[model samples]
Target: MSYLVFEQVTKVYGAVEVVAPFDLDVPEGELVAFLGPSGCGKTTLMRMVGGLEPPSSGQILLRGERLKKPDRRRGMVFQSYSAFPWLTVAQNVAYGMRYRRDLSAAEKEEQVQHFLALVGLTDFASEWPNRISGGMRQRVAIARTLAAGSEILLMDEPFGALDAQRREFLQLELRRIQQEEGKTVIFVTHDVEEAAFLADRVIVFTRRPARILAEVDVTARLGASRTLELREGTDFFGLRNELLHYVRSTASEEEGTA
Candidate 1:
């Protein structure tokens, strides 16, 4: 069985249906990117998976059980870096473990250190969130999510706030962490390049009432190292161009037809 399954999931707000019947099966340890334009239902789908909102119908299952509410198993990071201003970076990471009864104090501290290091924030562990760059703040959010013991990661345009260089740098770091930790990641992004570089499979969505327009197998063709230099290769460009074409043309076509 797959790690996560979306079975005919749909979302409606009043008279408007923001998501049409959608189905997807995601295996464990794979990073899948939901790519689409603004106001599309890509983020809505991710929110459902994170247990932040109820689906109008159908179900999302993680490891064969239905998701009912937000918990530590599904950790979400948003575009906005929402860290507790009062907490230092290390404390913010530890905050996620507040309810965890499985780990002792020493073990929890060890995990906080581990995840902070994974996101390259070990040096800033004691610094307040305001002292860090936007990029670093995002990293802190990520470490916090991971340290919370979430098996699945839901990232909603997490790198959207950063500049190009910082975004690219984090993209590389994210891929490395995913590979090492073997956690399933569902990344939501409107940027074609970012999706191409991060996902093992890129599920490009149409405009409103989101549906999967296309799914590109990235790792099969481009491989998973996903280094900065790989972005310039012909294969990488091909994947990026392919996603861009779908986002541009499919979005325009779907806007009026449906």
Candidate 2:
């Protein structure tokens, strides 16, 4: 059975339908990217999976059980830097663990140290969120989410605001962390290259009411490298172009219909 299943899920707002009946099965530990043009409902779909937005119809099942509300099992990192402004880096990373009754004070501190080190923020543990760069704040957000023992991550363009160099750096870091931790991830992005480089499978969506236009498997094409070298290769560009084509075609179709 799939770890996460969307059973005929749809989202409607008044007379406007954001998502059509959508069905998907995501296996455990797979990184799936939802790629589409703006207003395509990809972010809306992520919100439903995170349980922040209830589906207008149908159900989302996690491990064969209905996902009813926001819980620690699913962690979300939005495009904005969501770290607490007043908290130090360590404190921010430790924030999520405070909710867990399973760990003692010492254990939580250990977790904070471990995750801070994992994200290479150990040296800046005492610094405030405002003192760090945007990319570092996003790292804190990721560490905090992981410290909460979340089984799945819902990232909505988490690196979208950063400069190109920082964005690529975080992308590699995120991929490494996700792989090592073996967590299922649903990454929402409009960038074709970002989707092609990071996802095991890329699901392209049409304009609202959004539906799947194409599902591309990129794991095989990724080969042994997950670095800039891979992005520079011909196959990577080919896959990215294909995804772009699908997105453009969807936009063209929408324009014609309008």
How do the predictions measure up, each by TM-score? Answer: 0.97, 0.97
User: lDDT per residue, candidate 1, 135-236, as tens digits?
Assistant: 998888888888898999999999998999999999988999889999999999999999999999999988789999899999999987787788888989
The runs of at least 3 residues in candidate 1 whose Cα sits more than 4 Å from the true structure, single-residue gaps closed, are: 254-258
RMSD (CA, Å), each prediction = 1.8, 1.6
**Deviation from native of the Cα of residue 94 in model 2, angstroms:** 0.3
Worst-scoring 10-residue span by lDDT in model 1: 249-258
Clashes of each: 0, 0
- Give the true-structure RMSD of model 1: 1.8
Strongest candidate by lDDT: 2
Per-residue lDDT of model 2, residues 8-95, tens digit only: 9999999999999999999999999999988889999999999999999999999999998998999999899999998899999999
